[model samples]
Target: MDLEPPLSYGHGICRPRGFAKDPLVKTVPAIEALHPEMTEWRRDFHRHPELSFEETRTAGLVAQRLRDFGLDPVEGIGKTGVAAVIDSGKPGPSLALRADMDALPMDDRGGKDWHSHTAGVAHTCGHDGHTAALLGVARHLAAHPPASGRVVLIFQPAEENGLGARAMIDDGLLDRFPFDEVYAFHNMPLLAPGQAGVRTGPTLNGYIVWEIAVEGVGGHGAAFFKATDPLQAAARLAAEISSIVGRYLDPAESGLITVCSLQAGHSHNVIPAHATLSGTMRALKPEVMELLYQRLETACRGVAELTGCTIACKRLAEVPPCVNAPEGADRAAAACAEVLGEGAVIRDHPPFPFTDDFALFLEAAPGAYLFLGQESAMCHNPAYDFDDALLPVAASIFTTLVRQRLGYAGTHARSVAPPST
Candidate 1:
């Protein structure tokens, strides 16, 4: 199946609620009430960025905030991650809402006043915004407990390295706070601020990293035929590997292979005995991903044989494509439209080449991953910053999803069953 569909193209149908309406106006008063504290929370996080799997300070703050919101908080999942449960006073099925809490390893070039104080660590991916938005939901939901069911607010770590979600699952996150449905969101820099792009199925691509090493014989520059240069062999491999995207893979299939790094010897006059090359591989389908990997290995081996060199290949990180459940995505879209307005939520756009760890969660539960526009530069760029204006919209959307799934309006409140210990 062609997994690279146009953005916002959900196979399931949604009831029309008019064109592009603002869904937050009704909840504005409530959000406004919480705006000051939310902004402070985001700024504090922005000033202190933490890299993947090293979110101690960030995780601590999240746990403390959840406790203050009256939710029982659990920490140390996935090493430096946290999860909290808000049990409503009524009865219904449980729901989960997740937000990633790890920052990228990069220098902040945005020059914002609240830029990262930790050298070489920054929230270039807008994780600070995601964390604060979820915190906003926790605070709001705490003040006004949902009418029924329970809410599991997850503050995940190591999203940049694609390990947080996997860690939580392995640690029995679902078992601790079992739920019928789960949901998560990411901030997209390309889209306009305050606007959201939500798709029902196959939203993000799959990614794999490969490292190749070529070994040859070193010799002095004066030697005419004594040295077998691994650098030349590696160069040939890079050029040939680039063709995997264009020739080996189907033209219709979306795939990319880029050789990002190549390292060799130090002396200018001598041929290096070994050369190392590393790059990323991306595809929208599993078969295509496998095809790319196989083609790359074949190309590298062929180049090594022709050049009289030894080749070694290692597969690094592999993340599966994020496929949203059709029914779950439909429900999320309706909830988004109802909370952010039909106009504020755009249903169609291009699929992101980037990968998300949330795909792991979808494997165990029905859920949807939506994008909230940051209105800044692209993610991973040093110029990126989260637009605080979108926090209320996100929080309101989260709140609405909880209320809708539990079948409660704003007025009535209830308590839910305690999760089995």
Candidate 2:
């Protein structure tokens, strides 16, 4: 295949002394060479999306591919999640490179032949791309070993519901496969494809998903003052809950409480005994999340007393804030610059309001999360699909971080023939 001189602006590939120094250093070509095959895998995954911990088929395929690349993948680590390590057979700090594997419980109506066949399930968050990029790294790294170190590729499950990363952690992710640092990325909407972005601290918000149930006396709707209306209590509770973020929390601080759903009586003429209110609370810090929780319970109690109804709240899932290490964040931002040009990357970017399950990994070790740009409909939108061309862009970022950490020097990196297609 015809190739160009690997960019030397900052050092691309360092030639190992054992093999003849061939001039292919940049990751763009090394990963781009396998881009076609990677696209095939991405599209196939897009066509069949799975949700949360039920990613059996997707996880199986991931393990099979890793095996094909000569990495002995361990499957079902965190209930349908997969992980494996690639050792350089030398001493160096170990780092975990993670990619979430699971799709949202939604459907994409986008006009494409490869749209998901599963009803009410699709990869609107671009996980299909995330998974494919890591696999590309596995293939690239296998052919191109680092100077020395172990890089663990973790394909985690159930990120959508905010339990995947933590589940993996509780399943002994840190204890079994030790690492000094962790890294992962998400695709951003409304930016130029391959444009990279990172934030040093408070990279993402912490969030809590909870549901509150109200119980009261049921009676005929015509019995005006005889029945304790749970539906009324639920309505009042929802309004009071909405005011928590605005009234109790500082306006300068970021906090959001969204009421996603409310369920009450099925019949219009009868007062139901029970009503439910569910939504999410998000903030920039964990303490803020705790305060919100306290206020919510207080509001529920007040509403319960006002309507003479009993209320109980349960937290479904909680995702901690994603805060990155200062040095690790700088290195990741530099790696983005390496792949997407200095002008194309943005450090100290505004924090993402959304929550990430990957934050659990940061709790175990120092690491960073980044946004890879792709111009399209916003994520979680039914029409969104991951941009395939960015696979090489992501692959380059992953490898650059590994090489930067391990200290690039002359080392033997196996060679793999580029795809003919």
Candidate 3:
């Protein structure tokens, strides 16, 4: 939902938070200069949290900051997304770096100084830190322009609901700001702060949100024999759906099916005519996900026949698994190794069950999605906050990627060309 800021809420730049350096990670020397400001911007974003496609304030701030950094930012893309380009005068393969810009629809009980001011909204997934880090990248790249190729900065909205990346792509994002390679990262609480996780293939699972409906006769609770209880049918279907992962999936493969919600009659004395069941199914492989969906439908049919009820299943949303291209993954690992050392670059982590719409972008271009470690509460947890320490580390890695791909170097900086409108 769209929640506007108060009139007193100004878009002026936030004061630097003076974030301390992390001893374990060797961040880029150049990014260290912007650490405090990046933390401040991140906290500012956390304080004024916005949800899903309703990131007007966040987008406005991003566009304004990009302009301040001397880059022209296009607004209203994907409804509330923002993008800016830093063109290097010389001709070379262009690179795009992206960050999501939406907050979760939950309470901010973290009790931090910069806790979310809006009710029922919070930056629980570290998107605030991602946005702030990308902004820092923009500021750094604007000043230090790439050695040859251009860099496109994307501030995408609605990633939480798995729509932002597709939204931008459907709005001709790729055509408008074309790039040969793309890259994005999400903060992970599973590893130590500043450590990087990069897997060669299937970094994230594909998922489908599904709903099931069961129809039967309704009657008073007292009339037990006469009533055809849809709730019982729905309950059986839920149990059957839960078993699909274990019963149908291959032993070597991993998948998940969860029944998150079930709704039936409102009154305790009555049996409802209809019942609804909804949940999600996730798998690392597209074929596996398809198999799971097939099994789910089969289970529904069998449950319907056994209970003498009409059952129908509907798919709400689907996202393909995020597989990192070999070239992109290698570059990401090298970049991480350059910034955080080789030992900190993890390559053995299994595919995450979580889904990101960034999968759509990976499908469009050769790129990778890496996870930067943070020593904090798990993502989506109310207590989670993006480690300010990661600001410099993440920005450093993005900068190093440009240097590695586009031939940019800190020693010989080029004069930045004027940003185009």
The sequence of per-residue lDDT tens digits that candidate 3 reaches over residues 115-231 is: 999999999999999999999999988988877979989999999888888889899999999988999999876655656788898988888999998999999999957978899
TM-score, ranked from best to worst: 3, 2, 1
**Cand. 2 Cα-lDDT:** 0.81
Off by over 4 Å in 3: 1-24, 222-228, 409-421
List TM-score per model, in order: 0.87, 0.89, 0.89
What stretches of model 1 exceed 4 Å from their correct place?
Answer: 1-24, 89-92, 409-421
Maximum-lDDT candidate:
3
RMSD of 1: 6.5
Per-model tally of clashing residue pairs: 14, 0, 0
Q: Between prediction 2 and prediction 3, which has the larger lDDT?
A: 3
Model 1, 52-124: lDDT tens per residue? 9999999999999888888789999979889988787677878889999888878999888998999999998
For model 3, the local distance difference test gives 0.85
Global CA lDDT computed for model 1: 0.79
lDDT ranking from best to worst?
3, 2, 1
Better-scoring candidate (lDDT), 1 or 2: 2
